[model samples]
Target: MQNLFYALTFERTLDRYSQADTTEVDVTAKVDPAGRTAQLLSAFFGLDEGLPRIADWAVCDGAGGKDGMPVIFSHEVGLNTLEPGDFAIKRRSGKLGEVTCLTLAPADDPGELRTVLLAGQFGSESDPPVSVEITGDIISLDQSVTFKGAQVAVTPLEDGPSLVLAEKVPQGQWELGKAATGIPFGGGSGCPEGTAQVLRVTWEGGITKPDGNAADDQERKLYRVTIRQEDGSEETIAPMHLADTGDGDNNHKLCLDRTEPVKSIAFPAGGFTDPRGDLNPPTYIGVSQRLIDKQS
Candidate 1:
């Protein structure tokens, strides 16, 4: 009985995705009406043309104390239509806070506009922020897709850099398409040879590992990744290289060595240093290969 519904759902989904209806998926969940998986898949099948999504929310800290939250988007945002009031947040205590200020972090570089530091009267240590929501009309610079009323979880202020995303592609391009059907980078060449997976290590605030005097000159290595071989042996490795999308967004694209199946990734203290000369604290991430956002 369950298979029947899904069988029908899959057929409609493929048909819907192939045609002009780019709004939402038209799948029937009446067979498993109470099934949360069916409901969720229905929502995902019908996306808003893969508009700018809430990528990350990190609490921004400084000498002024923990008074800011940095919001990262999936795509480049149009700054001409941006405002602090376009966003809101929900504190851990369930208190809603309004964003009173917004600015591009590391304002020196106008090229990188993905990280916007949102300022407001967020809760104190007793009730720090937990989530952020979009409230106003904001468009992506890449495709002019307006993403509103969407929310995502946030990282705390005291935390250091961590591995947040796993993708098949290194850049901001989506797995199958680019930026949810907008535009893809590169000349249509696919992933590099002998590559298995791509891990995106990101920090809450902004960071840089400068090779030379230039801001884009990057120092990529920052992780000690352990892989479990088919023979049950574990081999640890270093980040071979970093992803260069021509901007700083606290992302370290560590390309994996073949499909050996990763067991864990260990980030050492001082492995990464932010623009402010602060070291990234040590953190170990347990990766479940079964589930990952495979967007290359």
Candidate 2:
């Protein structure tokens, strides 16, 4: 016989402007019976978007269980608090049925975040009545019911430089020279006028096979480049393939002009292979172009 279970996934971001704190929270709950899966839903009232903006949220099921008989709720919250293994929770009881809650916390060593689990039921005979555990800060639930909402705190990071456009460039592929300009420089003081910058590129994007022939698609590959500045800051630039130029003989090269400064440059080979047939396709290449300046 098939049974029905209710599931709800909750996610929220917490932003504290005064303390510059931000965090992400993820909550998941599901009921399963026998071997079938059930639909999860969230019932929100009023016009508010539930909780305030947070860093992130995630949810999952407990270990070992099926559709409805044994349901589990797991929640993961990411924050910047020094005490990562601590949390505060407030819950409202469901109209009918049973409810369970569990709480899990991370260790004090500063690696994993804590967790909490809460489990309960409207009518059931179990030892310890409503049980709660505190391991660092992770919670686990065994019985089942439902929860209304949750809240947490987090930390925020100021505007910072990051690595973007770190993908492989397809081979036999060419991009326009004009497209090479406009690479974003890491946010910092400008570099000297005449310095040689270096960029190290790597392959990351996926490849596909259009024709059944393994050799034809294998011949197509990608390239990339990386840029490094004098201040130890760096950026990467990779040529994006516009379209196939037929066969693969008419390969194009996107070059940086001499007028442009060479801050950094690095190129890596692409790695791609075909699975359906017995052919190892060409690797993708990434090129990192650095802006170089002429010595005064």
Candidate 3:
């Protein structure tokens, strides 16, 4: 029975497993014959791991009326994982700056925990930051993997909102697209035009019209897609007109006209606009799901 219980616990943790994982196991024993009460006992066990990686970084309003930037991690980090000297910044002019303080972007947004807002002189518009490095050990919340020397190039602030994530939607992911209506995928048969592919994209920030309203369906062309075909040919195309099935207001699905297999899909910047009417500069997202950042 003890072995079976241990096996169940291991299975439950399988999804979070990585390399050389270890965990502390606890045991509880029944105190009464009817098993109404329980007693705690110390125990042991182990298993997966993954290091924290930078997912996105952006410049925000600073504390001293300067810039307080946010660095988002791919994995959730421990609350106490921050330190002043853990990070190093490199700029286009080859100057360096040290982060003075760090905090969650804001306490209001519970979802912003993955982001660490920093205050320092990383770079300026004239001399943009080229990259960021993790010089000290950073630990993840789940597997507690240590992160160090993890460097990622900085996205130019002039390049408007970039992709936070993108992926191919699985079949039947959303019921909205099952039957084509006004902008739906279906044609006469309501079977979604017989041949269509869907690509889902999530931006770093919410997108809205110049008047700060939600964008129209046709506005998806803002981030135009260019795909390479299997036969070694490339064509630039916009997503087919479809109802917005984006997650929250920052994500959206792009329907593609289909005939041949596609090798890749990428988009240049400057097409998208923020609710505040900020224009996107340039950023590219491909089939491999390379993450991009934003400047707010």
Candidate 4:
């Protein structure tokens, strides 16, 4: 079915003089029982709301909660964590059968976690690759191609350095410019007749930093993508390493821009590999038609 996850971003006050530190907790799994209680205060708060520690809590509705109100729960008993007891959990308003499907874990920093729900539950560790025909890769302000597929199989770590995404803006050309001002910034109305928006898809994997510190110890991976157009033409997007210094600040190189429209994109079998020389089966995430709808 579908998988739902919750992202809880909050700040915790450790001591009087020390600075308040921020952390995130991911409730990826669903609680059991139709009317069970899902106590969240323990992991996030040590006391009551008067302390006011929570920043924001977001619920990402997955497969089962689309029709009904997003999976809701109630709190039972006091929220004091000093007392010993498991947090009571109950599924309030949703389908009870598959409500508790996902298994979750605690995340300190949520920036590194990039999750994509596998559409139609298609990809398996053992499925053969499929070839599809695509026309041309086109990017536009209104509608564009984007990715939506599997969860980021690679875990993110602060020490595990990875290449950042960069955009290229030529002189007299803006990355997200408006038609009137001729400036390369967002929030412009109307696009030029000839030019299109450029949308690039890059694979981010784990890598070791020069300082000999790899946080998660997950090695970096490299994979080349192949674009299949409707006209039966094939083009390959070269794989680049993490930019040395210039990421997005300096217009290093344009990987994908609003140039042409693409029919279908595909990844070859046995394309993914890590630094240690391990490979993964062919799998693809969903590419959105409007990835750059709005920066805000």
- Roughly what TM-score does model 2 have, to 2 decimal places? 0.17
lDDT of 4 by residue, 221-295 (tens): 333334556687866553222111111111111224234444333343433332222333343433333213233
Clashing residue pairs in all predictions, respectively, total 4, 102, 7, 36
Off by over 4 Å in 2: 1-223, 230-232, 240-244, 250-296
Worst 10 residues of 1 by lDDT: 38-47
Candidate 1 vs candidate 2: the TM-score winner is: 1
> Could you give me the TM-score of model 1 versus the true structure?
0.47
Clashing pairs in 1: 24-46, 25-46, 168-296, 169-296
**Ordering by lDDT:** 1, 3, 4, 2
Off by over 4 Å in 1: 1-68, 72-86, 90-96, 100-158, 170-197, 209-221, 274-278, 287-296
For each candidate in turn, give its C-alpha RMSD to the true structure in angstroms: 15.1, 22.5, 17.4, 18.7
**Consecutive 10-residue window with the lowest summed lDDT within model 3:** 42-51
Each prediction's TM-score versus the true structure: 0.47, 0.17, 0.45, 0.25
Ranking by TM-score: 1, 3, 4, 2
Q: Residues 1-296, candidate 1, lDDT per residue (tens digit)? A: 53345334421110000111132323222222122121000000001111112212211221122254556664445665566666667788899864444555332122234555555466556776777766655555443355566567766555544444332343443122211111111111122445456665444554544331212213444467788888999999875544433333444446665567777777667555543444567767666232233322
What is the C-alpha RMSD, rounded to one decimal, of candidate 1?
15.1
On the 0 to 100 scale, the lDDT of residue 117 in model 2 is: 20
